[model samples]
Target: MVSSYPVQFDVDFPARPLDRLTTAFRIIVAIPIVFLLAALTNDTVQGDHHSTFTFASGAGLLFVPLLLMILFRQKYPRWWFDWNINLLRFSNRVTAY
Candidate 1:
């Protein structure tokens, strides 16, 4: 007699050979993308000679503006709300990559 498990998994091996060169250099190829992800998330990139650059610095999630609008206008703008929500979603998706 045999007992059955609740869950089962199976995977087939690939027929084609894997690219060893690309796999070996994967980390080096991904360096620019890593920097891009960091910049999109409001990270500062510092360079030599006391130089520093920031990308999308002004594109931070809406906060102060939303607060001021909520306080004065007593309502949140649909576009602003959408912008903030989509920004977060986009960041999450990009980071997942």
Candidate 2:
């Protein structure tokens, strides 16, 4: 019989020896990416990235509109659900990296 699982995760280890110096400074080096992820996920208030960040409500990650649609309208838009799924996948990918 064939397996029927729907999702899977796999990670490959590095082939060469890791550098201790870089490893020690990994947190410092990862600042940019951490900030990027923060900007993508966090919904900031007044004066914070008022010009640069344009994502409203953190790129639909919270899905409050979708929740309202489901609660009041009794219907869920497929596109909104897909958007949430893709965002989650992207988040997972970044964390995995």
Candidate 3:
């Protein structure tokens, strides 16, 4: 006898073009701001160059992804779509427009 339980399933949805580009832009801009704030706070607490440099390095590392994302935003719309769709899982029933 089969149990009368709700089954779980995964949905395959395509990401929208604008959503992908916007997300990449937001991430590219936000990472540095976040890391900078954290580093500055740590530096204030510890009064040392170590945390400052650590944060700076992190910001530098983030720049590459930011630049790459900006450059490829148009070229890799589909890839961006996949990334964005995974990032923003809206309800399928929701209608916008």
User: TM-score per candidate, in order?
Assistant: 0.43, 0.48, 0.23
Question: Against the unseen true structure, what C-alpha lDDT does each candidate score?
Answer: 0.72, 0.71, 0.50
- RMSD each, Å: 7.5, 7.6, 18.7
Residue-level lDDT for 27 in candidate 2 = 72
lDDT of 3 by residue, 20-74 (tens): 7776787677666565444433232345666533334433455567668779874
User: What residue runs in model 1 are displaced by over 4 Å at the alpha carbon?
Assistant: 1-56, 59-62
Best by TM-score: 2
Name the lDDT value of residue 38 in candidate 2. Answer: 66
lDDT string, candidate 1, 50-96, tens digits: 89986554456555777889999998899977866977876775565
Q: Which of the two, 1 or 3, has more lDDT? A: 1
**How many clashes show up in model 1?**
0
